[model samples]
Target: MIVTYITNANDECNTRDSRPPKQGLSACGLIGHQLFFHQVVFCAALPDNTRMQVSSKVITGFKNVLLVDYLAARFPYFSAKKWAALVTNGRLTHNGQTATLATRVRQGDTIIYHMPDPEPPADWVVPIVYEDKWLLGVNKPAGLRVHSQGKFIAENLIYYLRYQHQPPFPDVNLVNRLDIHTSGVVVLAKDKQVLRQLSADFAAGQVTKTYLAVVHGQPAPPSGVIELPLARVPGTKTARQQVVGAGEGKTAVTHYQLLETLGADYALLQLHPQTGRTHQLRVHLAAIGHPIVGDGLYQLNDEDYLHWLRNGRSPQQMPLIQRQALHCAATQFTHPVSGHPCQLEASLADDMTQLIDKLSGN
Candidate 1:
């Protein structure tokens, strides 16, 4: 079951704060000037289990946009027609009053949506790697999302850790996230103070992370640095990123060393990213003509990728590997509570191992 509650957009106790109120709503963090809609799921055993979940958001930076247009852009999982139906059914409100299809929302407007809670799959198990008084580390399996997103409200790592684990960690918060197909170690902070410190450390480039990947071809140089700028492709709804002219997009740097060669078609590489950009590792490798094995979005052309997505992301389309071959092999950082250096590691997932073995004729 899920718990429903409403939180003010201007609440001072944000996601980074160490001590949020123990009762009522949970705080969702601010993204620049906009507040992100956050959901907290409670177990069925909890006393106040509810059928519906309430999500509220504060509008900003847009000028007199149609309600349906704004909702479609913000929540792409729901179509404009669906949002219209919800408005017609009186399930949405503007500033505490019922909203309609003709509603034009602007800055400072409050929109509230009441929707049913979705049940997520609960069969997958996540292995705990390390734990202490202030931090917890877990090896997230490939295909497990780090947080709740569209169509996967409760089927995520955080939801399982907080509600489904043998001993629920209700107060824990995520310190880092991995892409759904990338298997690796994920860190969570037990308290707000530790979360804030670790966040600062990440922002300051003090934390170190290493990744392993199997790419289609061998890089020319055994070891080198990739200094490329990346920007989102224009006029695309998927937010695909590509390398841009220097000084045009955000700066991204990565250091890579070839570890082993698999026959004549694939190679294993160890990567260290100096700057954290969205899809930096995958994009960098692809820009250098060695896209990671089974990365359909980056490896295949736009038309083919779109066709694959429309076809339900079938593994037969990508017979080389089931998912991207990249994995977060290790992470090193300073402990927020003890101020001691710590290092955590995760082994490669079985699928990747099998792919390598097949490529090498083992």
Candidate 2:
């Protein structure tokens, strides 16, 4: 069976080293098994002289910009200097021709940006919560992206799932996504039809996503529904959302119940969002002056957020619980294939558990 891999432009250069070196038949089988699960496979007898070239489609959002400008924006992990160098070296191309820094990319143009390979994180594992032929639910760790993005390709959960579990199908799509810094139960569909059905379930509000969060300050009424419209903050590159007027933004509703009062300044709460909006839970919580602990982006001022992005965390600027103190504790939906109810749960990650224990003096 032929499988397709969407890889960066540097894949061609690394084709020779794509698989582990051969040894005994048993060893080769083990390597092949590992690669199969990850949806990356090499020919049983790869010709020594063969090299495969790979390039990704240019997404529509980046059209009508200079090659250099669009590349910088699309792949923010690459430094301006690196982009300049790549442009100068004529490593980037458009439509099978060498492109310059000033090249204007139109819609549907294929760009070969020849990005450098980033090192994958060391020894990462995604614990399975529930798995069957049609779907998978995993306890996604904080700091692991659901899919490939800017600086994370091989390090993301989808890659790990493909390589480690080697599910029968090549296409595994995320039914839901959590922030890279938020750990929780993430659902994956084994194929396209299941993906479409699950997506419809989410859109029709048939799925329930419950989250656990620790926030600074006690909320009034302790438990209540927060009805707020959310929109992207005006004139900002950062993808930060804010509560807006009813007519101005998408409707977002969060029902929060305070579970425990950790101290005078902190509280543990359970959140159930009725509408799925970008950063809806975080923006709603922060708008009420109870930002999730360790959420540097939503909790801090804009300048502080930019500073945190550039310089990392600071003792004086960041709060306890380094990442956002939020976890998708549970998710509930009907099984798309089994025609039965399904509910999956993930325990609070060790970091959040430890933080809670410390705050509660447990």
**TM-score of every prediction relative to native:** 0.81, 0.77
Enumerate residue pairs that collide in model 1. none
Q: What TM-score should be assigned to candidate 2? A: 0.77
Deviation from native of the Cα of residue 204 in model 2, angstroms: 1.2
> Which residue pairs collide in model 2, if any?
37-162, 37-166, 38-162, 38-163
What TM-score does model 1 achieve against the real structure?
A: 0.81
Measured over all alpha carbons after superposition, the RMSD of each candidate to the real structure, in angstroms, is 5.8, 7.9
Q: After superposition, how far is residue 208 of candidate 1 from its true place, in Å?
A: 1.7
Model 1: residues >4 Å from true position, as ranges? Answer: 1-49, 55-70, 73-77, 85-112
Tens-place lDDT digits, model 2, residues 91-133? 6678878888778887678766543433433367678899888
